[model samples]
Target: MLQQRFFSATSSASKYYKITLRRSPIGLSKDHRASAQTLGLFKLHQTSYQPANASTAGTILKLKELLQVENVDSIPTKEQLQANKPDRGYQVIGKKI
Candidate 1:
């Protein structure tokens, strides 16, 4: 599956699944919790990406009750996602010896 994704991603038209956890799955069934984990969602309001494919579609279906999903033209790179994160209001300088 990785190899297939790798090759397909070389094309300019790659797509992604923009999945966000809209509600906590904390008190849900075990199946719900496992599906949430499968989608890389473990916290409320957390967002993650998955390749837009049939398998992901099936998983999304299983967790449809808890997720907000969309098909995206392209997945944001990690650096891009990081740039959009809220600042911690501090920066590291140097370690004290």
Candidate 2:
């Protein structure tokens, strides 16, 4: 039998992280856009959350290289989400991103 230790499916200690795209790489290149798209991040001020696992970590890491990554406990409220939007001047209202 084979053994695995990186991340177990039966584990119950998984955490969630909030990933946001602060800046837009519109004029950067195709590669950057593809990277953001792969992480489900396209438009600026867009946010997404994922389990704190190796796969998620890898995606976050990739985005971090270009955008920003922040670990959050729970999903942000509607107001909270809207407050962090670009129109709000990208303010740090609800929480840091």
Q: Which candidate achieves the best TM-score against the true structure? A: 1
Query: Which predicted model would earn the best lDDT?
Result: 1
Task: Please provide TM-scores, in order, for all candidate models, with all chains considered together.
Answer: 0.65, 0.53
| lDDT comparing candidate 1 with the true structure | 0.86
Model 1: lDDT of residue 47: 90
Residue-level lDDT of model 2, residues 18-77, one tens digit each, is: 778898877867876787787788788887776777877776665575666766667768
Could you give candidate 1's per-residue lDDT for residues 33-55 as a string of tens digits? 99899989988889999998889
In TM-score terms, candidate 2 sits at 0.53
What is the clash tally of candidate 2? Answer: 0
